[model samples]
Target: MAVTLQDKLVVALSSRALFDFEEENQLFEEAGSQSYVQLQLTRLTQPAQPGVAFPLVQKLLRFNADGQHRVEVVILSRNDPVSGLRVFHSAQENHLQIERGVFTQGRTPFKYLRPLGAKLFLSVNESDVRQALEAGFPAARVFPDSIKSAEANPDEIRIAFDGDAVLFADDSERVFKERGLNAFQSHEAQYAQTPLPPGPFVPLLQAIHLLQTLPANQVPVRIRTALVTARSAPAHERAIRTLMSWQITIDEAMFLGGLEKGPFLQEFEPDFFFDDQTRHCESAKYAGPTGHVVHGVANPR
Candidate 1:
């Protein structure tokens, strides 16, 4: 029988998203591919330091500590196969239980998300992330700017999500983009009883909510989810109704209108946060690990 990832919550991430490759990336940018390859080869024995997404990945993998294998993290990178050797080595050195990877040698790596049954794909490259979103996975462009909230809660896994585009379909967002806020609000109000179509991250949220339903004693780890979105009041009603229609319950929901989400996210201190627009992601990153879901009308790139 062929092996399958159907039953597991798979996270496919890029090498740079998992480990610090900035110095090597700089070499690749300035010198060339050959320099980057040589540097990776030379440093193959030296484990790379943890990158921004490491904390989130590490904690996520911890779900399998009891041998249930509920989570799997795979390296899906654009790095050459030779550099992949170093990625695996670094994972081993850091004691991260990552057992699988694909090194595309500079080819776009997002195409492999389906075979892996990836619930989420994280990469520093916006193009790969965009492609993954188009492929219908909860993909995000990770900001390697900083590792926010290093002091993660040992027993709880906290994930925050934006409403439109990230969790719900970008339909209303497109309306807002082309038709203005009043039109957007009215559209959502009209559809308050309707469940918005699933967005890129819906599967991820569904998988997580499923896990949340598991008996606490059986899982041994607690999952705390949040909807930190920009839709406020009248617009917010639709988002709430959508989740209600789906029977998904997030622990917290912040309808921040148009206020800066950074400080509020800081108070929440999530292990990871997802947003569709760059400005929101820019603000959220200051509070926690941020993933840019470059989907919908808000992100034209």
Candidate 2:
């Protein structure tokens, strides 16, 4: 079928999905120029076996259009026999177009490393994803049918973000930073009891929310959101209350308390991760694509 701009897409494949290089590359290069881009590449010492829950790749391939445009898969791997074999099998079995190429070569045991070959990986973390979307790549992660039905159209692109610095003003962070943790916590506690001010990304969130609420026939754009943050337990109460006050419904929420975001994010398989802090963003980038260091209000865009 002929490809359409509406059908155009960019996706990242996990190391586990790759099976072969030569075959997969041929398919992708032939699929369409400028239609596919590889975000990360790494060589694996051991090839990924099928039926092992290659969640990242599975998420990318789940959405299918009117067959007008086929999903292209980019397998970023180093020169490893096992990795190549894995990519080969994934493409054939899943009907995915694959692109295989060497991203980095070294003796290090870590086959999959970040910032590989100059391409970027989108992280599932709310902050990381927020930065990536704002930076411009909205179609970073692909949503499967199951996830789509829960909200509305599974085929429509979905993007998520955190509250504070991401969707709203970094005022919360500022309060904590300048006033001290206790002061910040008290401020949040106060606002937690009442409605808080709107955030910087509020406009964008409203636009997306409108799209989701539109009738199926009239909804041309497909976008969804979730609020995943580190505000734990009682601290999270405020953020939740504010969201309710705004009448915005996040599809999913994770209030992890200073925990490693990689594993949980792996489940969501977000297209990108955005955060002001490099610590969380660094880990998230490895698991998925990530965008770093959003310029805050002080910097002034």
Candidate 3:
């Protein structure tokens, strides 16, 4: 039988998002791909440092530690095959068991997500992330400088998501953006019984929820999730209803209304946080590893 990733929670990530390639990336930006390739070749033996998404990836990979292969991590990079050598080496140095990779050599890499059965995609490149999200896969543009996750929960994977645009459709957010908060609040309250549509991250969240439901003895690590949103009170009801309707449960939920998400996220100390708006991501990054989901009305084309 042909090998398949159908049952595994596959996460496709870019090289830059996985490792600290900022200096080499700057060289690529200022000089060119050739110079960048040469530099990577020169440092081929030196492993790169872990970047923003590293901790999250590390924890997710733990699901496979029991030899059940419940998770798979793929390097979907724009770097050339030469640079990819360095990436794989870095993974080895960091003790990450990443085996699959697709080095596009500057071509767009999102197109490969479908074939890879990727549940999530993380990249430092906004274009790749937006394209992946547009293609209906959960993708996030990781803040390269975002603070790393706290070491408080090594055996547990904690992920936090924004409600609108990240986990639920941005319909209410559209109203909030165009009409005003009152209209948005009214819309959500009136449709409190109605479940909002699934956003880009729904599939990923569903997969995580399924993994969390596995018997403790069958899994290698614990998974916890949260819904941290700006919605409060009446507006919050719709978000909760939506999750209930989907039959998916998160470990925690924070309806902060319009408060800055940073402080709350700091307390939660998630391995990663995903939000649609860049402003929210900006504040959340300081709390822990954060990704900007470039979708919905707030991120207009």
Q: Estimate each model's TM-score.
A: 0.97, 0.47, 0.98
Worst 10 residues of 3 by lDDT: 149-158
Ranking by TM-score: 3, 1, 2
Q: What TM-score would you give candidate 3 relative to the actual structure?
A: 0.98
Q: Candidate 3 on 70-187: residue-level lDDT in tens?
A: 8899999999998999999999999999999999989999999999999999998899998999999999999989999647688888899999998988887889999998999998
Expressed as tens digits, the lDDT of each residue in 1-301 for candidate 1 is: 9977898899999999989999999999999999999999999999998898898888888778788888899999999999999999999999899999999989998889988999999999999998988888899988898555556686788899999888988899899989999998898888888889988899999889877887888776788999998888898888888889889998999998899999998888888999988898888888888999999988885
Please estimate how well model 2 matches the true structure, expressed as its whole-model Cα lDDT: 0.48
Model 2 CA deviation exceeding 4 Å by range: 1-156, 216-223, 297-301
Better-scoring candidate (TM-score), 1 or 2:
1
Instruction: Write candidate 2's Cα lDDT for 1-301 as tens digits.
Output: 8633232233433342232233333544587322222311332223334321133334434433334233334544433444345456545566554554443322221223232221223222233334443543321221111111123234545455655666556777788668876787777877777755665456546645654675665433445566767667666888877788889888888888678776776666664444555566556654454444354542233
Residue 90, candidate 1: C-alpha displacement in angstroms: 0.9
Global CA lDDT of candidate 1, please? 0.89
Q: What is the lDDT of residue 70 in candidate 2?
A: 32
The per-model lDDT (C-alpha) reads 0.89, 0.48, 0.92
